[model samples]
Target chain A: MGELALRKPSGTLVALVAHTLRLQLKSALIWGGVLGAYAAAMVASYLSFGDPQQMEQIMAAYPPELLEAFGITDMSTIEGYLAGQVFNLAPLALAFFPILALSAAIAGSEERGTIDVLLGNPVPRWQLVVGSFVATAVSLLLIVFIMGAMMYGTAVLADTELGFVASVEGVLNLWPISLFFGGLALLCSAVFHRRALAIAVPGLVLLAMYLADTLGRVSEDLEVYRDFSVFYYYAPEGSAITDGIDWASFFGITGLAILFALFAVLVFRRRDIYT
Target chain B: MCAVIYTEDLTKTYGKARGIRDVNLTVEEGEVFGFLGPNGAGKTTAIRVLMNFLRPTSGRAEVFGRDTVKHSVEIRSAVGNLPGEFALEDKMTGERLLKFFARLRGVKDLGYARELAGRLGADLTRPMRRLSRGNKQKIGLIQAMFHRPPLLILDEPTGGLDPLVQEEFLRIIGEVRGEGRTVFFSSHVLSEVERVCDRVGIIREGELVDVEPTDNLVNKSFRHVRLVFEKPVDPGPFRALNGVENLCAEGPELRFTLYDDLDRMVKLAAQHRLVNMEYERPSLEEIFLTYYGASEEEDRDG
Candidate 1:
C-alpha cells in the first residue's frame, strides 16, 4: 500500500488533539473575551464601593439566610465581595461553554453528518473521545487565563487591591468545576447519539447541582443533600481568593472529570457512529 | 488472487428496520466493484460496516486480511472513504481541511492533493459553507482520492455534479484502476457503474441479490425489440416465440421484449415484407425491474 508506506507509528492522537484545539480556538477566544469583559466590569464596579465598612453595612441589611445562600459571606474586602459576585456565579454560566462544546464533540458531529469524515481517518475511537476532552480542557484553561488577566489588569488600571496571585487562583479554581461539567457532557455525548440530549442532560445536572448546593444552605431539611452536589465540593467562597487553592476539592473535582472522560472513551469505543 | 475486501455472512440490524442480512461478498485486489442498490436498500449500511462505523450484528468483515473491528485503524490506514451524506466544517476552507486530514494520516506531501483539486475544479480557498453542493462534492472526491490509498470506498460519489464533472470523476476512477488500486463504490446510477466498474453487485431489500461481471449482467438481461412491416402482419407467429414477452401488436407496428433466440425472431420477421426494425438495449432500471419481478413471480408460482 503506497499510503501505508508513509504511515507513522504515532502522532495521530497528537494531530487529532491539535486539530480539535485549533477548531476550538476561535470559540475559546469568544467565550474568554465575553467572560473576561464581565469580570473586568465587576472589578471596575468594585471601585464604586468606596468604603469597605459602608459596603458591609449595605450587604448586612439583606437577609442573612439569603446572603449565605448566595455565598455572600463578607463584602468588606474586594476578594470577598468579588468572590461571591463573580467566581461563585461565573462557573455556573462558564461551565456551559464546555458543556455545549464537548456535547457536540461526538454526538453533535454525528448529528451534523460530519463524524463519518472525521472518523474515516485511521485515528482510534478512544483517541477521538480523549483528544476532544483534552482539547476542551485546554480551551477551558485558556478562557480562565483570559478572564484572570482581565480581572488583574482591571485591578491595576483602577488602582484597586486585587492581588495578581489571588486573581489567578480564583480564575483557575473555575477550571476543575467547569471541566467537571465538560466531562459529564463528553460522557453524555458518547452515550447518546442526539446532541440535544447530550447538552440538555449535563445542562440540567449543572442546574440541579447549583440548586442543590444553594437551596441546601437555606433549608435545614435540604442540608443533608448538599454533599451530593458537585458544587458542594467546589467551595471557592473564601478558599480561592482569600486563603489559597483547596487542594482536596481541586483534585476531587479534577478526578471526577478524568473519571467521566475515561467512561466516555469506554462507551464511545463500542457504540455505532450513526453519521 | 487475494481479496481486497471480504465479508462473510455479514449482517446488521437497526432495531426493527432491516439493515443487511447474510451478505457474503469478496472483491479481489485491483478491481473496481460497484455496489448497486436503490435508496434504503442497505448499501450505506454495508459500507458503514466495512468502514467500522457500524458494528456488524453477526459474522465478520476483513479488509486486506485484517479484521474490520479488531484492526479498523490499520484497515482505515489503507482505505479512503467518502460518505454518502457528509458535511465539512463550515468555517474551514477545503485547503485547510485537507491539510488537517493529511496531518492525521501522516501524509507530508500535498502535491497529489493540489493536483486532485486542480483536476476536479475544487475551490480550495473558499470556506465549505460558501460552496455549492457540486463544489462541496468535488472537494469530497478530492479528499478521498488525494492520498492514493490502496482501496477507495465511495458512496454515491457523483451525487451533485454536472455531466462534464461526472465524466472527469470517471476518468479519475479509471486512472486509479489502471494503477492497480481497488475502488469499491456504491451508486444508484447504473450507467456510471457500467462504464467504470469491472463487476457490479445488485442489492435489493437489504440482501445481495446478484454479483456479476459488467458484460455478463448487460448481456444476460432482455432487450426491447420493435418490428415494422410494409403492411399489417399477423402477430400470431411472433406471439408464439418462446422468449418474447410483453408483446404488443398494432397495424404495421409490433413491439416486445426479446430475452433470447434473436436469430429465430429475425427469421420469422424475414418472411413478411419487413419495412424497418428498431432494436434497443433496455435500461438498467428496466432490467432490474424484470429481474425482481420475475423473482416475485417465481415466489408466487411456487
Candidate 2:
C-alpha cells in the first residue's frame, strides 16, 4: 500500500496521447499505403499520356462546366492533372478514416464497454477528448506525409518534373480538411452516446460539403451554399499544388478543428459515460 | 472508523426508467462492504455514480471526504475499480494492457501486477479476445488490485470465476482487509458475500431495502425445519402453530418453515416421540425474497 501512494497527474495526458498514437500506427500505415499507392500510380500514369498538348486537346472536347466540376483546368502538367485526379476528391474519402477512428475514441469505446476500465484510471475526461483528437491529428499528418512521399518518390522514379515543394504542399493541405471532420466527429461522439450518430453526422456533412463545393463551382445559384460548407475553405487545386499552400484556408480549417475539439472536451466533461 | 464512502440521498433517473432513488449508504474504512442485489437492482448504477462514470441526478456522493464529481480524478487515483460489465481491447494482451494502465497511473514497477497474474493463473501473454470469460475476469481482478490503492470498488469481481479462483480472490480480499484497506464490491452471489464481507447492503428494485452486518442478516431470516416421528402422527399441532408456514406432512415425516418460534417449536416437539430432527438455515436468496417479496405485496395492497 505504501508503494501505491498517489503521484501528481502530470504525464497522463502525454502518456494517453502517445499510447493512442502508437495504437493507430498500424492503421495509419495501411491507410497511407492504400491512398499513397493510388497517388503514386497516378503520377506514373502521367508518362503514358505520350504528348501533354495532344492529350490536353483530347480532354478539351469535354464540356467546360463538367471539366471545371472535376477540377481539370489543365492536363498538360503532371501537377495539374494529379491535382484534379488525386488531391481534389482524395480528402473527401481520406477524411472518413479520421472520422471513423475519432468517433470510436469516445462513443465507440463506451459502446464496447471499454470506457469504464480505461477511465477507471485517474484520467481527466477532458484529457480523453483532447488526447484522442491530438493523436488522430498526428496520425492524419503521418498519413499525409506518407502520401506526399509516395507521390514524390514515384515522380523521381519516373523522371517526371513534379516540383517537390508542390507535392509537399498538395499533400500537407489535406491535413486541415481531414482533421476538421475528425474534430466534428469527436464533438458528435462527446455530445451523443451512439457511435453511429458520431460517425454519420460528420460523414454526411463531408458528402454534403463536397457536393456543395463541386456543384457551386458549376452553378451560380448553388454557389452561395458553398460558403456554408467546410469544403469551400478546402482549396486543393492549382492554389495548393501550383501556387503554394493557401495560408488563409489552412488556418481557417485548422481553427475550426480546434473549436470543435474544444466543444468536444466541454461536452464530454459534463455528459455521463454510459457503458 | 472513518467513512471511506458516503452517499446522501443519491438519485439517478433515466427518462422514465428508475436508475437509483434517494439511496443513502456509508462504507467504513478497513471494512468489506458487500453491495448485494439481483440484476437490474441498481447496484452497478450506484457504483458507476461513485466512479463518476455516471453523474447523479440528485443529492451527492463522496469518497474519502472528497466530492465524487468535483474530485473524481483524485478519488480515482486513490481507488481501484473493476466495472461490472468489464471489457478490454480485443487486440491487446493482458501484459500490454497492464503496462499501459501502469503508465497512466505513474506506476513504474510491474512486479505486483506480475505477481497477481501468477497467483490468479492468468495468461498475460494471450490477447483478450482469445481468453475465456473466467480468464478475462481474472485479468480484471489483477488490474484493479495491482495499483494497491487504499480503496477498492469492484463491481461483480467474482463474476465468471471458477470456485478455485473465487477462493483465491476472497483470500486476497481478506489480506486487503488485514492491511486496514477498505473494499466495496457488488455481487448477486450471497455465499461469497457472506464469506468475505463485514457488512451487507441489499438493494431491490432501485432501493436499498436493508443494510446490516453479515451475521445479523443471516441470523434474522427463517429456517427450514424437519421432524421425524416414531410412527404415523397427526399434523394438526404443527400446522396450527404460529410462525410455521408451508408445512408438509407424511405418515412419519413433517416439514415446515420456522420463523422466530424456535422455543415454542422445540416445546411442541417434546410432546411427541422425536426420533430425529433437522433444521437448516435458508439461503441468502431466500432471505432476500422473504424481505422484498413481502414488501412488494404490502405495497400492492396499499
Q: How accurate locally is residue B117 in candidate 2, as Cα lDDT from 0 to 100?
A: 87
lDDT of 2 by residue, B142-258 (tens): 889998989999999998988998999999999999999999999888778888999999898889988999988766788899999898678888888888999999889899998
Each prediction's RMSD over C-alphas, in Å, is: 2.9, 2.9
Model 1: CA > 4 A from native? A1-9, A236-239, B224-244, B249-255, B260-283, B293-302
User: Against the true two-chain complex, what DockQ does each candidate achieve?
Assistant: 0.51, 0.50
> Candidate 2 clashing pairs?
none
Residues forming the 10-long window of minimal summed lDDT in candidate 1 chain A: A1-10
- Please state the CAPRI-style docking class of candidate 2: medium
Q: TM-score for every candidate vs. truth?
A: 0.93, 0.93
Q: Which stretches of candidate 2 lie over 4 Å from their true place?
A: A1-8, A236-239, B225-244, B250-254, B260-283, B295-297
In Å, residue B197's CA in model 1 sits off its true spot by 1.3
Best by DockQ: 1
